[model samples]
Target: MSRTVAMVIMGAFTLYFLIPIWWLLVAGSKDTGSILTTNPLWFADFQLFQNIGDLFAYRDGVYLEWLRNSVLYAGVGGAVATLLAGMCGYALAKYRFRGREMIFNVVLGGVLVPATALALPLFLIFSEVQLTNTFWAVFLPSIVSPFGVYLTRIFAASSVSDELLEAARLDGAGEVRTFFTVSIRLMAPALITVFLFQFVTIWNNFFLPLIMLRDESLFPVTYGLYAWNTQLNQLPELRSLVLIGALVSIVPLIVAFLSLQRFWRSGLAAGAVK
Candidate 1:
């Protein structure tokens, strides 16, 4: 009975998340006029490819531009954030130095602080420095993931061995070399976890980018979809486009998760065995 209940609960949770995407898939395949009237979970006209073509053709292929911007912001920013977090976390885990605990505590505190609260302050600071409303405005903030640092620190503490560092040093590997080679190998799962979280966070981020960027060209998919959404009443046809864009926007995230699922599963399995 307990196992049955657990399976039911799991199925319910799965459906809860899947239902919205399912609706989008079905809706994207329908025409603008049919979207509101037709079954949201079933295809009507089978216009998915046609709709995709229109979406790409709209505004001289602006959707593709938004896609590129999103890749740049999330992909590049997440990679840099993960690298920095891994290095910082490794240092915090392996080295004993003055103010190490204090610095670690500060990073943990940063994790607890809401990112939204920093938006206004960041805006004002950027404004003062003449950096607002530019690529740096959004890209700069996307790379600071305190939670990534915290998680990486914890993982580094357990996953990496101090004896290995000593052995590497004796073998004439410098600190940077040792970290890039030995430390990163052992902490691969943790770094991948950090990159995934940071990537998704940047990809889905709305408020900070919305606050910083006044130009549509720099807007990521989240903000771009929002802009389209706001004008849906003016252009009812935009509603279908927005839904399709929303569905398409999620594809990259799905791809990333699917591509990394093996590593993620192995990480979980390793943790369980340990």
Candidate 2:
């Protein structure tokens, strides 16, 4: 039947996506010698802990530094981006102000423009201001998420009721007070979604850091791994380290998703009921 065909297609797509992760898991479990010699899709040995220790110990624990940078960029940037997006979206949805539609339209246009396209101009602007090669070069840009604003606006327009705002206002609550104590709770799911999206985007960002940061210590994990990848010819031992670092880098993202998925499911259910 059609339902059977749908399930088959879904299974196919699932395997297609999961096969690489499985390979990475299998490969990360093996010693460097076994990786090329053994079956890539299955475990060769239980060397996962050993590989992790080697990865952490290499270069006096520079991998840990890169991991910390990634956490700082993604965690702080995602949180700030989510807060800004929520406030902008909530204002657009609730308040009737002049130029609001124009501003929303501008944000929509920004959503259409790819981040890659802005890198060059941003580089030039940052260079002029002498901000390149610093953490701000990446972190400042990461905090501006046009898509987050657009998504939050759409969610707020429907999910947040005007009556609730009226009640809050009548209760002697100020605008900022109402938003933090009232509207923010109602929009938790959307904000979390925005945070996850921005987090992943900032975490995986490579080109901007490659272009901006000349210092190795400032490199995020993605850029640091790429730097190692490029030097594989010089330091062949880095091959195993790069693989292990990559596998380790994704752990935070997985953790974030697993922790916040409940909010997403509840949001979906609430939307369905409405």
lDDT of 2 by residue, 1-274 (tens): 9999999999999999889888888888888788899888888778999999999999899999999999999999999999999999999999999999999999999999998899999999999999999999999999999988887888888888999999999999999999999999888988888898899999999999989999999999999999999998998888888888899999998999899888767654554454
| Model 2 CA lDDT for position 107 | 99
Please provide the root mean square deviation of candidate 2 (C-alpha atoms, Å): 1.7
RMSD to the true structure for each prediction, in A, is 1.5, 1.7
lDDT of 1 at 108: 88
Give the top-scoring candidate (TM-score): 1
- Say which candidate scores most in lDDT: 2
Candidate 1, residues 1-274, lDDT tens digits: the string is 9999999999999999999999999999899999989887898999998899999899998988899999999999999999999889889989999999999999989988888999999999999999988999989888888887777788888888888999999999999999999999998987887888899999998999988998988889899999999998899989888988998999999999999987767655554454
Cand. 1 Cα-lDDT: 0.90
Once fitted onto the true fold, the runs of candidate 2 whose alpha carbons sit more than 4 angstroms away are: 266-274
